[model samples]
Target chain A: MSIFETIRFALRGLVANKLRSGLTVLGILIGVGAVILLVAVGNGSAKVIEESIESLGTNTLTISSGGFGRQSSTSTSSTSLTVELATALADQSAAPHVKTVSPVVTSSSLAATYEDTDVTVGSFIGTHPDYATASNFSIKSGAMFTTDDVNDHSKVVVLGSTVAEGLFGTVDPLGQQINVSGKLFTVIGVLAEKGSSGLSDPNDLAIAPLSAVQESLTGYGSLSQILVQAVSADDIDTAQAEVTSILNEKLGVTSTSSSTPYRIMNQAELLETRTSNAKTFTTLLGAVAAISLLVGGIGITNIMMVTVTERTREIGIRKALGAPKRTVLNQFLVEATVLSVIGGLLGVAGAVIGSQFTIMGTKPVIVPSSVLLALGVSVGIGLFFGSYPASRAASLRPIEALRYE
Target chain B: MSAHRANRPVLDVRNAKKIYGSGEATVVALAGVSLTVHRGEYVAIMGSSGSGKSTLMNILGCLDIPTTGRYLLDGVDVSKLNDRQLALVRNRRIGFVFQSFNLIPRTTALANVELPMAYAGVRSAERKRRAHAALDLVGLADRADHEPNQLSGGQQQRVAVARALVTAPALVLADEPTGNLDTQSTADVLAVLDSLNQSGRTIVLITHEDDVAMHAKRVIRLVDGKIVSDQRNGHLAASRSAMLRDAYSTAVYR
Candidate 1:
């Protein structure tokens, strides 16, 4: 028979066993859905990481004490970074590519209160005035602490937007006093809100003059980490090299080896590492999901085999009616392909709906290419897995089949 | 037994032999059987179970090849053709009516009638027209849209006959076409076959019932892989020719 007639016959056969056909389609539906959802999650995480990197500003770098690389005894001794080193790095002659520098010490779980409204700041940061410009922070209301305030160890603090809202609500907190670890400090300024970025949200922390936090909270002379900003995006590498040498000189280290005393994280490298990691995770998840697709293909084969056996008499009748073996084969194969195509379309719909649900704590991103590819694979699965049963149907002897009852 | 006829026979078999298996398990289904059937002949092959009638019917239908034979079907050496060529021969030259009606389930009567021509690559429009005409010939024109399950036993068999005739094949091979029908349905099917034969269609029906075989113009009885008797029904043959004469006169007057 012609291909069109054969396909019509196959469709009729599938309709006769609706429940079985629907169940078979369900297998492929789930397989494609899993594949699309996992791949989407991978793409979504990569996109989220890229956006976070943009928010961090492309020319900024963070230099923290304790080297990230292999640390031996020689490298370990130079890990002690003091606030004095930060002062020397601020000099233009020592690091010409550096635009600004800020020494920072961060402590977690410091409760601040104004009257009965108590707020636990996620992070309490102590840094100099340059910290505002270096870390992309802006003054929302009151003025920032001055250099004299830093040197005199003034008890003055600047609340991040979220912290300010939590501490004083609509009331002006510029001259109001709040207790930080039982020590009263005057609120001098409120930094503008910076949402979650590649690094933690800057608006969730409270900032103060370096000297005040050093004596009142941490009671340490050593600085936690330093925030550095380059003169321009193109000068970030040069600024990093200049800062490394300056830090080495200030610590009296003559040799620079693989085990540096401090680690420098540039904005560009951070973005690249995170995006590549997300891609790897996506590929791994996609591979696992593909295994279920393979199983789904096997389900098609199993169902096709059963259909061929059940329709032996019908095959015999067709053969007796002068149908060629290839016609019989095409009928069964077309039925399987139809099943897979229907399942694939349903899977695309399911994946789209599934993507809205959070996976790995992030919403999935369904890639168009992945949807098309998954659909193609499902059709291919039908053809590949449907072959044996179709051939078996084609090879049935007319006389035996007619007599099969 | 083969008979020498004035005209070329539609089916001619010489010493046809068919064996089921090899060596110790061998069962010779048809042993040195010979037969000849001319065009427009309504013949019945009758025998009990294990009498090799099915084997003979299978050979005539081109569904199986003989172990050793010279079988010429409409001037072609059917025994020498390959599986695909044999299928083509069946499609173009032979039509089959099964005992179970064997109409594809869930299909309209018209589609079942059109099936053989479809396999023969007949275009859709012509296939539909010819299928409708065949159903009309079998007196099932009104039931063309009905599925086999929705039709009575006699209507289903009539649809089968229409399917067999749609191809205008060289031979109509019916194996127990009315076995599953009631007495009234059997009479209805036999009347359709008789009318088809009267219109010059060639038919070979396989059955063991004497009453069913009595409807045919000739009867061949098989026993132990051999033809035990070949008899012509003088009364039926005479009446068929007289009816043909009457049809010819009516056509002339029209």
Candidate 2:
């Protein structure tokens, strides 16, 4: 028989049992859809993390106290990061790759009030003007506090977008005074809105001049952390090395000591770690979805077996009519393949449409390779699972099959 | 008898034997049976249950191979043919009509009739034309679009007969063709077979009913896997020839 005629026969067989065929298709549909949708969600979350990390600037490095080591009583005082160390790191001749250094001190859960509005700030940060450049924070209205304001110990603060909206609503707080821990400070600027990263909200904090904040709220303790920017992306490693060696010398700590009290984190290294972690997550999700696809393939095998058994007499009739074994095998194999192919195409459509909306605060980003792999696997499943049942039908003897009830 | 001998033998069976099991609990379905049927002959094989008639019918239809001995159909030694070649032989040389009218469910009568021709690799247009003509011969021309379930038992059997003849095979084997039909429907099916035989088509009917076997020109009775009698129905043959002559004369007069 011709290929076209075989395909027609297969289609007729499928149509004869529409409900069973539809259910089989639905099984494959869910599997393919799950594969594409889950993988897309995984990839999307990874992309979100990468973008947030990239926004922090690849050329920047953060030097913070409290490393992954046992703290020693003798080194506690020397391990504290201070403005003196920050100044030393800022010296061009000592660390030529270090473009800027901003010393930061944070006071968590600070109560601030403005007239009738009262809100608790997540982080009240005290840093120099270069903190804006180091942290990639751009001012939306008004200007950042200048170096002169830090030198003069001005009581000025910049509100993050979320904090500003919470304290002032629609009021312009650029020049208005807000009370922070019983100290009145003028709002010099409002930072532009930045969407929250999955781990934390970046837009719910406030920044102030380091000297005034230290004098009022912190009382001149050691700086919380130091933000350092490299001259270029390629200089981040060199800049980190320079900072590490200088801090070691200034604090009288050995470079090879296992109990070092300070840690230098490169943004690039953090980015690599995060991206690899996301890759692992995507693979995990794909594996889970692959299991469902395999189940769907088994569903095909189950349905085909049932169909072969149910149509045994019809197969006998065809055999008696001179149909070759290959023809019967092809007919059934084609039927299974058509079922899975239809389900796969519909699943791709479902994934595309589902990806258009945000899922769990992450916009799904469909990976083209995942889509192609899913479709290819679905088709392969049809043929692989379909072969056994089709062969069983083909191998049936004409007399025995006709004798079957 | 001389004229029948002059015709080429369509079926040549030389001491065909069929054994069921190897050792204990063995059953012999056919025991050293040898028979020859010529072209354009209407032969009926009759036997009670377990008389080996069904086994011989299966062998003759090419649905089963003989355990020992040679059987040839249309001059081909089907005993030695492989499964694929046997399937081809069955498709191009033999037509089968089962007692149950095994039409593929949910398929139109026309497609059912075209099945054999399709397996023979006939083109779609030619298959359709020949299928329609065969259905017309069985008086089911207007029921071509009906499914098997939609047709009555008699009509369904007639459709099976059409399917059996559409391929113009060397021999038509009917296994209890009227066993499932009522008396009236049996008469209708037998009439169609008689007309087909009159038009020079070879037919082999397997039945246990003496009344059904009476319609055939020759009857072979089997008992315990052995043929007990083989005789010509001389009176039926004469009446059938007279009927054919009367119809021919009427056609000429018209």
* Second chain TM-score, each model: 0.90, 0.90
Q: How many residue-pair clashes does candidate 1 contain?
A: 0
Error at A21, model 1, angstroms: 1.3
Q: What DockQ does every candidate get? A: 0.67, 0.71
**Considering summed lDDT, which 10 consecutive residues are worst modelled in model 1 chain A?**
A68-77
Writing each residue's lDDT as its tens digit, candidate 2 over B146-195 gives 99999999999999999998877778999999999999999999999999
Q: What shift in Å separates residue A11 of candidate 2 from its native position after superposition?
A: 1.1
lDDT of each: 0.87, 0.91
Q: Write the per-residue lDDT of candidate 2 for residues A1-405, one digit (tens) a residue.
A: 899988899999999999999999998998999899999999999998988887787889999986675454555687789999999999999899999999999999899999999999989999999998788889999999999999999999999998999999999998999999999999989999875556678988999999999999998999889999999989999999899889888987785677667888899999999999999998999999999999999999999999999999999999998998999899999999999999899889999999999997789999999999999999999999999999999999999999999
Q: How well is each residue in B1-254 modelled by candidate 1, as lDDT tens digits?
A: 12232145788999999998899999989988899987777899999999998989898999888999889997789988877888898898898988999999888999899888888999999999999999999998999999989999999999999999888887899999989999999999999999888777778999989999998988999999999899998576664564455344324422
TM-score for each predicted model, relative to the true structure: 0.86, 0.89
- DockQ of candidate 2 is 0.71
Q: Backbone clashes per model, in order? A: 0, 0
- How far in Å is the alpha carbon of B44 misplaced in model 1? 1.4
